[model samples]
Target: MGTQERKALEKQLRRSQILDAARMLLFSSGIDSVSISGISSKAELGVGTIYFYFKNKDEIFAALQEEGLALLYSKICKFIEKEPAPEKQLAGIAEAYYRVSEENKDYFDIINYFLSSPRIFFEPGLKYQIDMSGHKILKIIQNTIATGIETGVFKEAQPGRFSIMFWGTLHGLLHFKKLEHTILENENHRDLYEYSVNKLIDAIRCQ
Candidate 1:
């Protein structure tokens, strides 16, 4: 590779190293507990190097959140591409979400942390980017519902509103995983999730 391209690749690798460290710290500890020094230690990089890539812990955290959301959006798109039916597309979207939580727990935790905490402040630009990332994902869901409606497979309903409710319900149901051994003892969480998804599909199906 050319000198300029090699240097660019190296810079990107360094940034990934720092972000990976910060993600680990965010998942193991809490966001408030993550620090540049801790990330540098976790990454085995110099503090100066960490600062070279990120302005502060908040910046690093924001980067992680943005990266996680983008990854989710990409995964959802891939899942949708693999399914031809709108009903199957919605199910694929739900499965993709669950797989991300199971397989990419670090990203899921970082995204969930910011989403569940409304008190946290983000710069307007960063906030808008994050909001747009989420909106894009929701748009896919909304459009899928609209497609189903257009084909006469789904009952007439407001796609935009139903999309929000659908996503919110799935997200809320996922959180119940923490209660599996307590309130949900003897219940299969996956079964519950699938049941919820099916019921939502049934609700909009033209009878």
Candidate 2:
């Protein structure tokens, strides 16, 4: 390989290394607890080196949040690929959402942080990118509902609002379970997610 290519590859690797360290710190401790020095310690790199890659911890947080959303968007798109049946497509999408929470708990926490503090995305270009990534994910749900309506499976109504209702319901349940309260504790705790999905499907279906 040429010297230029080697240098470019190394630069990308270094950036990824820094980002990975920041992600670990953010997940282990809340975003408020993550600092440049802490990230440096966790990354085994000097504080100056971290600053060289990221202007500050906020920049790193934005980058990590963007990456998490992009990954989630990709996963849902892959799951929904070319399925003509809208109901089945929604089932897959719902399952994908549950899988993300179950499998990528760290990313999930980062997303929760993002939702709690949306003002962080106010930076001009960053907000656009983050919003576009989120829009893509939401489009999957909206499109599924639109298709279901066309096929007479879903009740005819506003697709956008229906999509929000579906997503909001699931989001509410997921966050509720995250609380320390024992109200959600039961033998079938794990099954609450499936129950939510089934109830949502029933609610949206044509009567």
Candidate 3:
């Protein structure tokens, strides 16, 4: 590649290295314990280099969140495309979400961490970007529900409101997974998740 292109590619690689390092630290230690210097040491790069790519630990964390959300959105889109019917598409979306959590635990953990901690804050622009990424995912669900209604597969309702409830229900169920051995010792977590998804679908399905 040309000199400029090569330099750009190198820069992107460096950024990925930083993010990877931060992700490792996040997994090893809680976010409260993560720091810029720790990430620099973990990546085997200078502190200045870490700052060159990211302003601070928060920015690095936000970048990771953005990456995870983008991955989720892409996966959801692909899952939706593969299904022929709107009801099936919603099921596909739920499966895609579970697969992502299983396959990308680091990303999922960081996203979950930030989401559960409302006290954590980001700059307005950064927060907006992350929020928009999330909104895109929700919009897909809302649009699919609207399509199902239009086709007479689902009952008429406010797509936006229902979308929020649907997403929140799935997310909440997934979060309860940690308590499985205690609270759900007699139940299969995956079965419970699928059952919840089906119930939600049934609630909206035309009678």
Listing every candidate in turn, what is its Cα RMSD in Å to the true structure after a full C-alpha superposition?
1.7, 2.7, 1.5
Task: Report model 2's TM-score to 2 decimal places.
Answer: 0.84
List the candidate 3 regions with Cα displacement exceeding 4 Å.
1-5
Cα displacement (angstroms), candidate 2, residue 94, comes to: 1.1
- Residues 99-148 of candidate 3 have per-residue lDDT tens digits of 88889887778778777776746878889888998999999999999999
What TM-score, to 2 decimals, does candidate 1 have? 0.92
Best by TM-score: 3
- Is candidate 2 or 3 superior in lDDT? 3
Which digits, one per residue and each the tens of the lDDT, describe model 2 over residues 144-190? 99989998998887889888887777766677766534765553545
Better of 1 and 3 by TM-score: 3
In order, candidate lDDTs are: 0.89, 0.79, 0.90
Instruction: Name the lDDT value of residue 32 in candidate 1.
Output: 75
Report the error of model 3 at residue 81, Å.
0.3
Model 1, span 86-126: residue lDDT tens: 99999999988888888988888778889878775577877
Specify the poorest-scoring 10-residue window by lDDT in model 2.
180-189
Per-residue error for 153 in candidate 1, Å, reads: 1.4
